[model samples]
Target: MADILFQHEPLIRLGAFAGAFAAMALWELASPRRRQAIGRSVRWPGNLGVVVLDSLLVRLLFPTAAVGVALLAERHDWGLFAALSAPTWLAVVASVILLDLAIYLQHVMFHAVPALWRLHRMHHADLEFDTTTGVRFHPVEILLSMLLKLAAVAALGAPPVAVLVFEVVLNASSLFNHGNVRIPAGLDRALRWLVVTPDMHRVHHSVVPRETNSNFGFNLPWWDRLFGTYRAQPEAGHDAMTIGIEQFRDPRELRLDRMLLQPWRSDAGRYPIGRREPGG
Candidate 1:
């Protein structure tokens, strides 16, 4: 199974990514939930450009990435599960869940730590929220996330197949939850019980600091609920609430070049974990 997965890993991930991206793009256009502040022409090029840059950066820095690391660990009988002689199926399920929890905690860390938030806020700084917004993470954050995932895989002795499944599903879920497609309210509520639906994640992208800190889960919705960070809806209706952060509202700053320099150019302390009281 591992050999087959390794042989087809690239194709599998590429297909899932392309398929999810296209579907979300089309759906967002067909039934967008919010009126876009910045048009697709302005937003997509920069967002997708960052994705390209992130891909190149990750490939250059870590040729193997998380799945590759998992394969190696499996071969050497490394990590916790391997040492404990856990069942293959059990290890796979446990790894995927634990990895998801790790990501949820990592996201909270990014928001709480000012320096890390500088990189993460780029994702929140987009003037509009949509599918492309999901892939707009700064390259630095991408590299850091990869290192974290690789470490988790090594520590847990995650099955290679589980790591592959997590990567592909996480990518797809990020796209799904970040999309602008208008899902039915009833359906959105139902979906959030199991996964982070578009509505659930849109709250996290809200300009309001409190909303921005909530709903940090990218794939699973349970973590936020369990951790008491879950928010049902944006205080302002999804269509009414502003997206992006309080600062960097200038359209000129939305360009790819400006976005790359954002962390250094902007103050890291503007947005933090708690709500900012008015009348400052």
Candidate 2:
């Protein structure tokens, strides 16, 4: 039962795939003009495929290293994995939060390293903010992130159940931030203190390079808020802010081939990718 549940958890989140689709479709209807201009341009199915590929690869390879590290760390008390202490539900919740914290660090590394930035930029290349856009990542970035988390999982000796829960929440949050669904002002403001919401994430995708550098937290917004990278659009609407690389404002450059090669292009006029953020 645990195996079956873990296997499909990626397909079922708090906001399931179907739910995210409905939310996005609703946003598309409500804000037809703004969404249609860029949001409509994205290919949803292709992005979903990326998620499937990345998830499967990690799940298959992840267990070996994760289990190995847990075994190695068991020798030392502080380095050992957490034993199941609370109810199953509580353990899972704790796992998800811990894993999200780990993700925050890995995200920062992607922006700080030039080589990694080249690949990670593919995620930022999307002009659209839709559910499926979350899965749009350079293959290299996905592999590196998986490895980083593997080490974290080992060092912390996180429980298996928690790991399972963490993967589901991580996948869901990825979709949440990238999705185009509208967030109500009051709730959005409140949620920002906990998880990284669509509003917080929208800033990370801004066309302006400076604003894009802030808000690197994955599942939690406080990571950014605490780290001092959090920035929200002031006095106005995310409605006015645009998504995509600063130089690659052109929608065509958002395609897979162009985004994959974005770093190589010397001309920001042609590509529009920006310099790395200070202390990124």
Candidate 3:
């Protein structure tokens, strides 16, 4: 199973991404939670473009990717799982959970660190929030995130299957939780306990600085509650709350070239967690 997965990792990931994206796009069209001021024509092109660029860069720079690193670690008896002589099932489950936690921490770090926020803020700069917003990360941030995930996979001695599962699930979950589609309030409340719901994750994109800092988890909802970064809803309410950062309010910033240039265009602004004024 592992060998087969390793050989076909790209196909598996692409298939999952396409299926999830299509599903969410349809769902959004059918039951959108909020009216979009800016249509997909204005945002999807740049957002999708970023996905293409990020994919090509990752494949070109780290051809083997995380699953390959995991296989190498297992062969060399490297990292925690190898040292503990853990059972395969336990390693897989624990590795998936730990990897999610690592990603959660990385998200928070991106907001808290000034320099890192410059790269990550591009994702938050989308004037509208939707499924495409989920995958709209700057290339530099994507590369840095891949490096972090690679290090975590090797250090944990994660199984190749587990790494593959985590990667696919993370991609799918990002699309799901970032969708503009609505869920019934009762259902959304219950779903938040198990997975990050769209409503829960939307608060992270709120224009308000503090709201933007909360609910950083992309795959799991627990880390936010565990760390007290969870915000139930935007202060203005989801329908009324504004999306995107203050710096790039112009629609032109939604273009691919402007997005690529955002990190160099200005000061980190008031959004970086470290830059927030005391009691403001």
lDDT of 1: 0.91
Q: lDDT of each model, Cα atoms only? A: 0.91, 0.65, 0.95
Better of 1 and 2 by lDDT: 1
**Residues 1-280, candidate 3, lDDT per residue (tens digit)?**
7778999999999999999999999999999999999999999999999999999999999999999999999889999999999999999999999999999999999999989999999999999999999999999999999999999999999999999999999999999999999999999999999999999999999989999999999988999999999999999999999999989999999999999999998988888885655587
- Across 85-138, the per-residue lDDT of candidate 2 in tens digits comes to 345566456656777878887777777666767777778777677766777886
Q: Could you tell me which 10 consecutive residues in candidate 3 have the lowest summed lDDT?
A: 271-280
Q: What is the lDDT of residue 164 in candidate 1?
A: 95
In TM-score terms, candidate 1 sits at 0.96
After TM-score superposition, the amount by which residue 180's alpha carbon in candidate 3 deviates from its true location, in angstroms, is 0.3
Tens digits of per-residue lDDT, candidate 1, 1-280, equal 7888887887899899999999999998899888876798888889999998998888799887888899999999999999999999999999999999999999999998888999999999998889998899999999999888899999999999999999999999999999998989899889998999999999999888878889999999999999999999888888899999987899987899999999897686547675364753
TM-score comparison, 2 vs 3, better candidate: 3
TM-scores for the candidates: 0.96, 0.76, 0.99
